[model samples]
Target: MKSLITAPLLLISGFLFLTLAAARPQLNVLMISVDDLRDWTNFLGGYDGEVFTPHMDALAERGISFTNAHCPSPVCNPSRTSVMTGLMPSTTGIYSNSQWLRPNHPEATTLPQFFKDRGFKVVGSGKSFHHTAGNNPPDQWHDYFRFPWADFPWTRSNKLNYPWTEWQPPPPEYPFSKVEYLRGKDERDWGILPRKESKYDDVVIVDYAIDFLESHSGDPFFLSVGTFHPHLPWYIPKRFHDLYADSEIQLPVFPENDLDNIPPIPRKWAEARRDEMQAARDAGEWEEAVRCYLASISFADAQVGRVLEALENSHFAKSTIIVLWSDHGFHLGEKGHWMKSTLWEEATRVPFIIATPGMENSGQSSSRPVNLVSIFPTLVSLLSLESNTDFDGPDLTPLLANPDAEWSHPSLIDFGYGNTAVRNEHWRYIRYNDGTEELYDHQTDPNEWKNLADHPMYQKVKDNLAEYLPESYTENVPGKNAFVFDPENWTFTNKETGRVVHGRQ
Candidate 1:
């Protein structure tokens, strides 16, 4: 299928910052990012019944799959910042979606920029870093396509052809089109697109990536192909939806009293989605909503298939290293919560896979609890690239070499100040701002249903896990373009004119 948007043979932007020696053999890197995808794929088995994701499962078979991977933060901006910069959100003071990292943490080196500094060609397209251009360093790439996204992103030329008014990722509330099953208003919506596949923005991204892969041969390139699907509004092609039957769709295992057992902070967050859940139940659209999400994921998988095929068919396939990951996990009404931005397992857990060409021991699943915060260092270690700075997460070469490596490093997940969750092999310990705690034994309760934080028997467990939380943390950084944050008072002031805006906690 062709892109509905104007066909560009190539989307190239970036200048050569460093020079590569003629004799050196550079390794190519292919980074694939899927937005808001949870562990519902066939390989993860988090979701019951059937979820169609053949391409991703195939990719998992070709690399070391981190079965127990979690994002630093559940939100898009902060999670991407941590992964790209290899810096934790607490250290950088970037906690919210509005907070931009490039300005807040200027000294840190990004994953692609690190490669660029090492005399490698970096190319990117679509949503690599938080969907904001500022998060993506313009000068770091050899070539990049900043625009050209799924379904009428911008451009007055094709505006009339597509219905911008009705078709989009939900407006955080009800009234879904096409699925007709959703009868009432609620938070989050979904629908299948009736237009041409070329209109899809992600398809254009793959096209640009394929163009680069086929044309470029000798230079070591770091290609980032980002896909914005299965994120929200669940807008996707009808054909992908056909792959799944509604009868085969399985609903999430939502406990009736899950929120009652949740800690204060997360319980409060989960309560906000009460209206959304209630609406879903009232309308009997629970399965329909999940159906669209799974379909959108399958659509995303198809895009991955397209990009991988291009890379495999390319001359550099044998020497390239492929790393596929999502910014964070999504919540399809798991913990009575609708979306991400919590310290729970559903929101923080993500799909992380690393495939290096000719690795002796490949296609293994490492069940070790690992955080995505150190993706920068992990890649650097795998590629043997040089960096001027250190990273929060260390070299996982040992784990990659041996999936059952004895690792004591527990995965740490955080959301703003005073709230953190530490996940080890067995336990998930959560400490909120109010000094209250919640713990879950993953071995007995994979769904994290039973909060054993107050269990007298597990006090030692909490003490030991508390050791993994961040030692030092700054107040949340306010966006320079948007607002100014006062760490001392936990308040937000207007950026311009220094007027007192509002107090935040």
Candidate 2:
């Protein structure tokens, strides 16, 4: 009798232990961010010519890709701030790169801090946050590796004590492109850097991330790895540039009257960078510039491949979740623009992919429009953490389970104070601060060449999309000039008001 009772008790205890472990299993997160990467990968087909991004393509094959994902704002600071804080630009008032995020909203919980608060070892490297002073606070992460800005040797030295400006120029072979107009220009130029791939900063950044993944032994971790490539001064190793040397470079279609029907505000935004576009065209460097961009994309993709390989080989492979996204899209002479900061598809549309362990619908894509702001809440739900009610976006778990789930929320893109764009499955509607409107039917005009906002037939469509816009706009936050920040102390002093606010330490 005693032997039988002891055997049944042991079985019951073993079953209870297994059930508890299954209920709350440890889940790790690996988030990869690429800067200025648009929808030009082999998966998205944003580029017309042949593009090589095997690593990202392979990751997409094993993950659920959101084909219609967009950023909360087209600019860097606001978009990244939205992703970190789970707040939109209209709510946070951080509309541009110059506006610091911590000074404006210090009480908000960042994505890293959320995980860190819940006993996760949160750490990251590279341009995970806006690469500006006072933007990336110390309290958000248990550990972080700041980006090495000295990698780019051509930029101007910061004489005015500005952020990310103190850098020495390279040796005599400075402007490798040798384009006449791009001779002295810093960020606009691109060429082959005469160096080994190991010396590159992105490679270094990935090395740090890989080291962490291989050696981390503790509670579950949230590892963020960001790469600043294809953003500006598109310099990469010679081998990467050589990969595209023999291929035919196809530039984006720039119609003669592309800006004819745009409103004044966005029309000015497009025309703002027209001189850069024209200079490249006149110098006959258009194809070379596009090639450099594609090569940079390939280089970034290689770094991504390295990180993925590290994760796969690690002991945490089966329990980790991988997510890859770009802060915002890039505009390579699309719609008469050279870079981001426009509300058009070229600047707003980005590559978003998420892969979780044991996902039934892995390797599928969702056409439903989504925004990056949902990252925080979705992670909360995925990790079974306590939910925060202040997230501006909804949880995307349903879409993760079923790619074709009924998702009604369209992706919203905000630029300035009142400039907003609404993108759905078939239409894109823009409303400027001056109340001017522009609408394009993606089914017919994927290029957004024609503006149907003036057409009386699309009034209902405009009104229906317009209802999704923000009802009230938050005032612009204080610009960089408005405060004197002390990085060591993590404090901000208003220039005019002389008010001191303690930042995250």
Candidate 3:
């Protein structure tokens, strides 16, 4: 009789355990991606003047802000591919925007695919991946909208046939900034768009995200909402431009001899956009360009606010995890560069924040040097998913739990095949493909105005940071010139090797 009673009690306890486990809700992920956003927000304080970023600042308050986060690569295609696939550019050979991900790496499971495989409703809109035709495969998500500018009339009319094309026809007085160099070049131009903000691509993308948040109910979701603002052609609504007064706009500190200490490789990177910088300076439109960028950032912040408001109103708000990050940082006349693709502090340091449900250390900040490559594995850990050994980055759950955890790992930023930058808490060490190096002690030079790699005193420091560099870099895969891409069939045929690879439609 005693044995029978014991058996019944044990069965009841086991049933209760299973029931509790089954009733627990799975954590959903809301990934917000901002393209080419640097550390200029109100929180990061990378800028000198007032930058309107209330939404991003509030989001930082809700999570652990990684102040030292850097991209896996300093360019879009390579950096996004590395973040999504959990592989470094050095390992995948995806070192530039010209190379397509699917044609080169067919087997790597992307972050969304990892969740989708485990029964999550994956959806995305806007420039989540590189906003190119072949780079963002459809099968990665259950539903996705490509960089929405492709649907605009100006884009469809071939007036500007690029993904980052102007969303609408320029105002008749084009080059609104009155800079002659930007007259025909739409990519570099920035001005007030004489239209309603509702019609913009970033606004439309945020609307899609809001709709999904409101209506989503079934399986846990992995929703990616990407904003393509503050990227290029900073053309935005007039209201955003109104936020910044020209008198309040402060230009970045431009040292006349800033490039004198760097190696030849990065010197070339600085000179790459010198002509554009010169034109802006020559026209005295530098302040206007900075104002446009600030306005664009405010515009992007508004879009993020829309999505956050929708999520808060939805039922999934309490159960969801919010991860906001930029693909890579931008250089707005810093280091004498106008765009990304450099391995400098401005080009590599991005805005990274992860807000998990019921986080104990909320509103805290972490200065641990972390790479965006950790995003994939970090999400996998947060969701309690099976670990994959193929990830080159470590699980960042430890840092999430404790912002000041003992983390020795340095953030690695790769540019080209052999050009890499290792950034830890104190120093930034850059090694070019040709073996020339540049080292800056961040302790003394936060602006990186000086190079210390040539000094024997910092040789030990350089050696310590150099250990984090890639042991070997993979050779670059076939670029667009080496393959014929058939958009109709979604396939790439290598011209020389005759190898055919099918891409997801």
Please report, in order, the local distance difference test score of every candidate based on alpha carbons: 0.74, 0.84, 0.83
lDDT for model 2, please. 0.84
lDDT of 1 by residue, 324-438 (tens): 9988887778888777887888898888988877654577899998988867767776665555554666667677667898898988887887688898889899888788999
TM-scores across all candidates?
0.85, 0.93, 0.92
Candidate order by TM-score, decreasing, is 2, 3, 1
Name the lDDT value of residue 160 in candidate 2. Answer: 29
Ranking by lDDT: 2, 3, 1
lDDT of 3 by residue, 1-505 (tens): 0010111111111332233235555889999999889999998999988899999999999999999999999888999998888888888888888898787667667888888899999999998888777787677889997665732334333321253345566446667777898666646777887767888989999889999998888999999999999887788898889889644787788798998878888988888877887799899998888899889999999999999999999998788889999999888788888888899999999999999877778899999999889888777767656644367777787877778989989988889889999999999999999999999889889999998889999899988889988898888877877777766677878898889888664
lDDT of 2 at 275: 82
- How far is 100's C-alpha from truth in model 3 (Å)? 0.4
All models, RMSD in angstroms = 9.5, 8.3, 7.8
CA deviation > 4 Å runs, candidate 1: 1-24, 147-187, 480-505
Worst 10 residues of 1 by lDDT: 11-20
Residue 94 accuracy (lDDT) in model 3: 85
